[model samples]
Target chain A: MERILISGPADPRLDDFRDLNHSDSRPDLPGGKGLVVAEGPLVVGRLLESRFPVRAIVGFKNKLDSFFASFQAENSGVDLSGIPIYEVTRETLATVAGFDMHRGLLATADRVVEDSVASVLEGARTVVVLEGVGDHENIGSMFRNAAGMGVDAILFGNGCADPLYRRVVRVSMGHVLRLPFAHLEGSYTTWQRSLEELSQAGFHLVSLTPDPAAVHLEDALKGRDKVALLVGAEGPGLTEHAMRATDVRARIPMAPGTDSLNLATSAAIAFYERDRSQRT
Target chain B: MERILISGPADPRLDDFRDLNHSDSRPDLPGGKGLVVAEGPLVVGRLLESRFPVRAIVGFKNKLDSFFASFQAENSGVDLSGIPIYEVTRETLATVAGFDMHRGLLATADRVVEDSVASVLEGARTVVVLEGVGDHENIGSMFRNAAGMGVDAILFGNGCADPLYRRVVRVSMGHVLRLPFAHLEGSYTTWQRSLEELSQAGFHLVSLTPDPAAVHLEDALKGRDKVALLVGAEGPGLTEHAMRATDVRARIPMAPGTDSLNLATSAAIAFYERDRSQRT
Candidate 1:
């Protein structure tokens, strides 16, 4: 492992970790070669193992050593031989991240080209379809929940936020890096074609709605081999065109006078039911 | 429906609705009235219908009219003739709230001394027990989820945030006003006794854990007539003492290498499963 000591925040070599909050907006951000910044040891560890090519890491020596100890003792198969680990004082690290909290470590990497919907769904048994989910935290939570619940992949309709945005990455607990995802081309009309693609691929597309007239979730899942659970933004759910394309509208039975559960929570219930049904 | 036209934010009668963000802590600032402010027409509507003594309300004519229309059309049974409905300009409304997104209405009510744990449990067939959940948004979401998933009530064990905090009230979509909640006095030791109290009252105490050895959620809910789902903060879950008092430990059955689901999401799943089982 290569250890580089950086005493101040001004070193040119530590440029990858400088002013991270504003770095994403740089025309050169992430995919453009400015490097994607990951905070903390957990996300950094995930980034190390992800398909994205890691450039370098910056952190306090203790955090780096603690991270390295895992590989040494557990033989975790993670290697950091050639990657630069820049050790900085806590104060200098804070200055670089532009905040007092950077989880005591940060990692940067080049963003990989996104996978197509067909590729992400190649062998997936269950997938999540999201529409107009523009909120970053919700998107992140959805990915986190999706990963925990064993959803195979995620597909985005129009009006979705960038999954690689810093907050989204942090909120997803780095699951956004691990989960396979794709964005559907065009609006609801072509998004409907995407649904057709799923149908042609032997997937049962079920849109989750709050309407009482919709079929109960349990009933919607009955007799389905491969399921694609569709969710939309919190207030205005799936477009009518998208809804008309789905096989059926399914709702988690809700108590009276309550708004729909948060989008992420709604998707989680759908995912949990799907996961539960498979084993039961 | 006597509407009082208040021209400015300086009016003494409109004091309750002034500088709402800081009003909660204002034994020292703002209106000097320590009232809980409910924002937007929807929450004001809930506040109007709640048992909490409403001091006054302020809103635009359109918002008030829309809210008034609901009561007239639905026979909502809320009488607000004596309550002062202060008509304020949108500019004044934003100035008072310290932000432009005021949702077109705001209401203030004296904080109700919280209900007892026994009272909240008296009729609750299913409820949630939270421990060390310090996040306001999480608390609010739990209430929203609790209300939507048909959980009867919520009991706070230890280290819980105030559910009436403005951010929480807004995040819960004002379900905080509609859904009933109680705080259990004392620490985990007495909180454990509270769990015993629930058990003696015929509520099955099931603690939600990420532990692999725990009974799966579906199996934990089997053959139970009444259930109380125990959840803790996201990272450090239920304290061992609290877990010890639980009748059984239940887990949501997450995938490999993933962290525990978010606290509110975890509770929502448990609540949904309970709601589903009771119906089927």
Candidate 2:
């Protein structure tokens, strides 16, 4: 890897790293020359392993050396002979990013096109489908939980936030980048068809709700081989049509009259329960 | 309840209800009257049932009326004859609270003195001890999880946040008001003494961690008649001294190299495991 020294903030080579806090929002603009950014050492490492094309690496000297050493250790055949690593002081890096701290490192990569829903669901056993979960933090936490609990893939339905959004990426601790997810774009009929496909593939469509009339989660998930857990936003919850479409309306036994748990937390528990039942 | 019509923001009777967003922080100030505040209809309803003395209720006319009807239904003998129920437009309520869109209702109540740790643990089988958890949202969720998982009480250790903070109250969905909890204020010595007391009362002290070497959570809780689950904040986790002080260190099975689960979520899973084991 080639090392470059950047002493000034206005250097054109640093353009991809400029005003990153805001540029993260317009990643699709400027003929889609936008960079997919990974912050902190851990996330940066994940970015390196992802399918996204690496553009450049920027960090302090120590971080750059440490990252390069680890990269070399992980990949022996990969020739990084032409890759440029820009080294700058922490203060300069923070200024270039328009933030107070840089979390020690940052990397820019070309955004890869997400796989289609059909591709994401290929050979999947358990999956999560989300609707109207517009909160980025909630979305990120949900993906992290899904990854941790061994959910195979995530599918986003209508009214969802951008998973590639910076806050979501950060909150998810970069699990959004690693997890296999795809958008389901189109009308409600299209969503219904996609869900029907999963159902045809023998996935039990479990709609998670707080409705007392729904079967208990443990009882509902019994003997299921393939399952798709459908979760909605916290307050309004799943739309009536979506709930009606599911095979089973399952609920975690919550204390009576309490507001439903945070969408992500509820989903995590549901995933954990499913994993436990399957293991048993 | 006496329906007081306060048409203006300058009314003295509504003083306790002013600037609620910042009141919990500066409790020493006049506006920060140390009054316990409950927002939204559900939480306000719980505040009414709590031991805290209701000081006043300020909200929209319909909301106030509905609350009054519920109060009358639940306690026919209690005279709310003179307790002021201020009628205001939603816009006016928002202005007085220093925010837009009041969750349709707000109530002020005197903070009730919680029972001592000893009193809270009387005849209790399980309790949660928290240390250095200064986040109100985490504390609130902990209380809610404790209630749902049948944990008996919550004991706050050093550096813990105030459970009555408005965000905590809102996040807990009024469970903080319904559940029993107390502060352990003396010192490390006092905290240790409390644990010893709990041990004498037949509770097992189990500290939750992500350490791979620790016993599995399910294995640790098996056959335990009484357990005290200790949890700490997300990043720093349980202090070394605290970890050593516990009877056993138990770990949730996590994917290697992943960040630990959120504090509240981790606590909930531990509580869930304990409940599941006890049932068998």
Candidate 3:
């Protein structure tokens, strides 16, 4: 990687890293260059390994060196000849970022086209389908949990947030960059029809709800070859139509008065149960 | 309940809520009133049902009216005659809260004494033991999970944050006020001694870790009559000393190369698995 020395925050070459917190979330910015921004070495490393195309990087020399070392460790063979890593003073880096980035480094990647639901679902055993889960942190944590629990892909129905958003990337610890996700086909009403593909692919669509009449999550997944756990926002769970589409209305039984768990935690439990059921 | 009409935000009675976002996190504030703040109708309703002694209530007339109606519906039979419900305009409520509490309602309650570790463990089928889980939001979510999953109590080992802090209270959705919890007796080294009591009470101490060599989470809990699912913070999972204190180190299996799950989500999974094991 070539080291492009930076004197201050104003260099045009460093525009990809400037006020980065603003750029990643706003797709309507100039030229629609809303690059997917990954912060720190941990997330930036994931960004490098992801399908997203790297634009450039800004960091102190030490972090840049370690990133290269980690790349060498992975032996990813990703060509670095054209990727310029701009080295700057810590002060200049923070000023450019508009926040004191303790990680002292960042990288920007041009957003790639999202994969289709079918491509993400290829050969998958379990996937988590989300609806109305528009919170960035919730989406991020859901991706992180989905990755750890070995769910194959994540598909969004209606009212889902952009997974590539900067906060989502940071909160997911970069797992959002690694996890395969796609928005479900069609609008909310027709969204149910799109799930027909998963059903055709032999997925047992399990919609998680707070209804006591629903089967326990464990029993609901029993003997299913492939499963898609559908979850919704915290206050208002899956819409009536969304719930009606699922093969099973499943629940993690709760004490009498408590409301539903936070959407991510609920999804994590469902994912864990899915993994346990398959293994056992 | 007496409905007191407050003219503005400056009333001395409203000081409990003034600059609340700052005061709740700062225990050293003058007068030393660390009041438990319940914002929003959902949480305020939980507060009305909890054991915390309500100091007073403040909100617009509509929300206040609904709260009394809810109190009557619950039919707690507790005398509400002495508790004054203060009424104010939206502007006054915002000024009093230092920022608009979109919850449109607020209630103050005196902080109650915590239960002893022994009392918390009594009759607990499962309890979540947290160490170095200092983040307020994590603490709150842990409480919520523990409560919903029917985990009898939460016992903090060390380096944990105040569960009653405002952000925690808000994040837990008022579960902090309802759940029973205690800081383990004594300091870090001596805290291990408290585990002896749980052992004597027939509780299995299962420490959660990221080590793949450990038993899978489900396998680790089989045949255990009562369980304490111990979890540490996100990074630097349970200290070696903490891990060694458990009867077994258990892991929620992860995909290759992922770090530990978020502390609250990790504990929630364990609680869910524990719920599953107990039933089937």
Candidate 4:
């Protein structure tokens, strides 16, 4: 690996780490040169393990060495001979990242290709389908919950944010890179058809709703085998069409008059319920 | 009731509703005019029902009238006869509140006298005790979860946030007003003494932790009647003294690699488990 030392703020090679507050949003722009940037050591480690092509890692010398040691130990075949581990003082590092606290490490990698819906569902027993979950933090949190709660994959329907967006990645605690997810293409009809395909493949399509009339989650998932839990944005929950298409509409029995739980928390409970039932 | 039509933002009576962004934070400052503000119709209704002494309501004329009509129908004896209901266009109301979105309504009330820890715990079956939970949003969500999941009251230990803070109240969906909570004074010694009092009162104090060796929450709460579930902040968790002070240390059964669930979410799940076990 080419281990370079970054001393000053205006180094041309550190362009990938500049003006991160604003330019980070326009990852899809022309000449965007958008790299999957991971902040903090824990997330940086996940980025290194991910299939995305690692470009370079920049951190304090000691932190960079520790990261490299762990990276080499984990991946025996990882050829870091050409990769540069840039070491700079804490002040210089913060200036380069345009943040006061960088958590001692940052890494940039080429964005990986998103999987197709079919590819994500190839051998999955459980999946979470999201609709209109535009908030980046919520999307990231859902992915993290999905990963932790044993969901096989995530399927994004209409009006969802980019799962690879930096905020989403950060909020997901790097689970976005680990979890298998794909955007569902086509119109609402196509999305419905995709859900039908999952149903045909022996998946139980369950729509999570706050409707008082829906079956309680515990009762609904009591004996289900393959389940696809569908969730929507917090305020305007699942659309009527989507609710109608599911085999079961379930609710996390809530106290009367309270607003619904945050979208990700709701999804987490549902996923927890599903996992709990399977264990029982 | 005096129906005031305040078309201009400069009206002296509207001072309580002015520059709400900053005034709401430092409610104790001179000329601060601290008021318990409720946003949106649902929370406004809750604010009206709560014990807080409501001063007045400011909202769109249509929504304000509807609120008053509902209060009248409920025969709430809300003492609105002397209170003013400021009627304004949504735009003007938003301007007075220093925001473009006002959620169509607001209610202002004098802060109620908080219950003492002993008072809040009077005749309580299940309670939640928090420590070092200084974040308002987390505190608010905890209250919302506590109310929804059938917790009797919340007792704040050392280093807790004010439950009546606007963000906490808003995030809690006004449940902060409905749910009983009291702060403990003095040091960790005093907080420990309070826990001991709960124990003497026949309450089983269960401290929640992420330690793998701890008993599972479901197993721990199996037959406990009066239980006080102790929760701490997200990262550091409960202090060692708090953990030792409890009768038992319990843990939510989580997926192997995940750190821990959000503080409020974990508390909700624990509360849900207790409710479920008790009902069954």
Candidate 5:
């Protein structure tokens, strides 16, 4: 990594790191360059190790130095011959970013072409299919939980948010960068039909619902060879069209009169149950 | 409920709902009245159903009218004759609250004395004991998940945040108000010693950790009659003293190289597994 001393917040070299708090013009937003951003040293390290092409790194000198040393120690073989590591003071970094980034560091990566649903499903035993989960934090937590729980891929259905969005990356602890995810392509009304491909790939599509009539999650997943847990947004769960396409409707057996679990937590329980069932 | 029309934000009757966004002087914060606030209609309804004594209600006319109608419909025998429901325009409500409360309504309640840990554990078949889980969002999610998963109570150990914090109340979707919880009375270093009481009450104290060597959660929780799941903060898990005091440390077998699941998600998974174990 080449260390470059950058003094002014207005430097042309820092454009990728500028005005990040601006909703419309932030480099990572859709209206801007549509780049991916990883905040904090831990997430930035994950970005460095991911397949995405890194553009630049900007941070306070001391934070960058410690991060680089630990990153190299963990990944000795990483070749960063051309990546510019911009070393700036706290004031310059905060001014350039248009906010006090308490995390103190950020890295930008160009978004790569995503995988196809079938491509992401390859060599997978457990996967998560999301519908209408537009919240960044929920999507990020989904990726993190999926990675931790050993779910192999994530397929986004209708009304899902961009998985590469900056906050999603930060909230997922950068697991969104490492995890395999692909958007299911089609119109909103017809996108669920693509789920049949998952069925053809020998997946037991389990729609997670709060309906008491649904089978318990453990029983639904007990002996399945390959499972795809379908989750939806918090307030309105999976659409009837989406649920009808799945093989079975399963639930976590929540207490009566209580609201359903948060979407990510619900998916995580399914993932955990899927793993537990396999182990036994 | 007496529906009183308040035209001015400066009216003294709105004191309990004033300056809600200020960190120091918010009615719910330590420097102010230390009252419990319930935002949104559903949460306010929960507050009405809870044991917390209602102080006042303030909201826009339409939101308040519909909420009160449904609340009364749901609880036919409950009396609200003495509670004052302040009717104000959107601007007045926003001005009084010091923020644009998108939820459109708020309710103030006097903080009731919390139950003792021994009393909360009296008939609890499943409970969660939290340690050092200081984040408000995580604590709120813990309560919500505990309620949905049928956990009977929550016991707060050392370093935990107040469960009645405004953000916790909102995030828990009012479950924090409905769920029975108690603070474990002890100094920071000696709190883990209180685990003996749980054991004496015939409850299995299971500490949830990410350590690979620990028993799998399913195996650890299977066949336990009464279970108390111990959860800690995100990064540094349970302190050694806390884990040392438990009967067994259990793990949700995670994929290698990934970070542990979020604290609340981990507890929810444990709760799900505990329920699954007892069914068979």
Candidate 6:
């Protein structure tokens, strides 16, 4: 790893990590720099290991050292000599970020071309497709859960938040960087037809809902060789059109009169159930 | 339902819901008022149904009307005639709360005497015992997951956050108000002994962990008639002492090299597994 000692926060070399609190919201938008930022040692390390090309790293001296030591220990023979690591004091780093830096480290990477949905699904058995999940925290949590449960990839339908947003990346524990994901390009009809293609590819497209008529999650997933768990936002779950396009409607067996579980939590349960069916 | 149209935010009758951004943090402390504040129409309706005595309610005119309408329709016989509902304009309500109210409704209730762990455990098949799960949002999500998965009660061991905090109540979708919970009083040793007592009471004390050596969650939960899932915070999970006191160590099967799932998501999966075992 290449390390450089820097004495001041106002240095232009650190501009990529500056005013992060205000600048990170729409970095992926047109006319924006389209840079992805990862905070904390764990996330930065993951960014180092991901497909995205790392541009620079800025953090306090101790954090940068610790991150480098662990990263090198976990991954041997990977050269990070070209990446510039700027070392600054805690106060200097905080001032440049324009906020109290809780994690104390940040890594900026350029957004790469997304994988096509077909490519991510080439040999996958389990995947998650989200619709109208606008909350960054929920989207991030979903990625973390998907990674833990061994889901192959994620596909965004519509009205979903930017998975590359800083908050999503942080909340995802950096799994968003490692997980393969792509957006379904087009309107509602086009996505519905995409669901049809998935179904034709022998994937069991199951829409998760809280409706009493839906089958239990385990029963829906039982003996299925391939699965695609369809989910939506918390309050307004999968639309009628979306549910109609799937092969099965699965419910988690909730107590009467209780509202449904959080979107990510519900998806995790479904993923767990799918994993269990294969395990036994 | 008693509906009083109050015109201004400064009305003395609306004091229970004033400056909530700052006041709701430690309401259960000695120096605090020991009040339980519920925000949003859903949570406020739950507060009305809970055992805690209602103090007062303040909200915008339209939200209060809609809340009353749905509440009365669902609960035909419950009398809410004594509770005062202060209705105000959106601007006045925002000023009193010191922030823009996203849900546009709030209710306050007196914290009632907690039920003993034994009382809540009577005839219960599943319960969750938390230790060091300090985040309010996680606690709230745990309650909602427990309720949805048909877990009977929740018990706090050590280092857990205040479950009655406003953020928890809102995130829980009011499940915290409806579900029963109590803290295990005293030090770590006492709580460890309480775990032993729970075992003596014929409950299968299963500690949830990320340790690779632990048994799969389904294997641990299968055929257990009464189960108490012991969980810890995300990082630095359950203390060694706490896990030692349990009967078995359980882990959700995860992909290699990924960090463990979020605390509440892990708990939800365990709860769902336990519920699934009983269903079939």
- Misplaced by over 4 Å in model 3 are A26-32, B25-32
Q: Residues B17-120, candidate 6: write the lDDT tens digits.
A: 77776666675455466578998877888888889898888888788878888888998766687888888888888888788886788889988888997788
Q: Put down candidate 5 lDDT per residue, A41-92, tens digits, no spaces.
A: 9999898889999989988877888898889988987777788889888888
TM-score of 4: 0.89
Q: Backbone clashes in each candidate structure, one number apiece?
A: 0, 0, 0, 1, 0, 0
lDDT of 2 by residue, A1-280 (tens): 5789999777888887888867766455653345678888878777777787778888898888887788788767655555578888888877788875547688787778789888888888889999888898999898788887788899988888778877787788888888899976756545655677778778899999988899888888887999999998889888877877789999877655555667888888888778778877
Which residue window of length 10 is worst by lDDT in model 3 chain B? B24-33
The TM-score, computed over Cα atoms with residue i paired to residue i, of candidate 3 is 0.95
lDDT of 4 by residue, B1-280 (tens): 7788987777778776777765555457765666778887878878888899877788887888787777677755555667678888877767778887457788788886678877888899999999999899889888887887778899989988767777887999899989888876658556766687788888999999888899988778998889999999889999998899898999877776765777877887787778767865
| lDDT digits (tens) for residues B10-53 of candidate 5 | 89999888888543233554657777899999899999889999
Query: Which 10 consecutive residues of model 4 chain A have the lowest summed lDDT?
Result: A19-28
Which sequence of candidate numbers ranks them by DockQ, best first? 5, 6, 1, 3, 4, 2
Show pairs that collide, candidate 5.
none
Best-matching candidate per TM-score: 5
Question: Relative to the true structure, how large is the alpha-carbon lDDT of every model?
Answer: 0.85, 0.81, 0.85, 0.81, 0.88, 0.87
Q: Where does the lowest 10-residue lDDT sum fall in candidate 1 chain A?
A: A25-34
lDDT of 1 at A57: 87
lDDT of 6: 0.87
Candidate 5 whole-model C-alpha lDDT, 0 to 1: 0.88
Model 2: CAPRI class: acceptable
Give the TM-scores of the predictions, in the order they appear.
0.92, 0.87, 0.95, 0.89, 0.96, 0.95
lDDT (10s digit) by residue, model 3, range B140-241: 888888889888888888787888888899889899888888888667666767777878888889999988899999999987899988898778888787
Candidate 1 lDDT over A1-280, as tens digits, reads: 7799997988888887677777655355453334566777778878888887888888888988897777456646767678888889899978876888646888888877889888988999999988988898999999999999999999988888878877888899899999999988886567667678889899999999998999999889876899999999989988888888899999999998888888899999999999888886
User: For candidate 6, what is the total of clashing residue pairs?
Assistant: 0
- Candidate 3 per-residue C-alpha lDDT over A181-269 given as tens digits, one digit per residue, 9 for 90 to 100: 89887777778778888899999999999899999999998878999999988788889888888899999999877867988899999
Candidate 2's residue-wise lDDT over B1-280, tens digit each?
4677878877787777677777766366655667788988888878877887888888898888787777678766655655678888877777777787446688878886679888988877888999889999899999888887688899887778888888898888889998899877656545555567778778889999988899988888999988989897778887776777789999877665567788998888787778778767
DockQ of each: 0.87, 0.38, 0.83, 0.43, 0.93, 0.89
Interface RMSD of each: 0.6, 2.0, 0.8, 1.9, 0.5, 0.6
* Segments in model 4 whose C-alpha atoms lie over 4 Å from true places: A7-10, A21-34, A60-79, A87-104, B7-10, B18-34, B60-77, B87-104
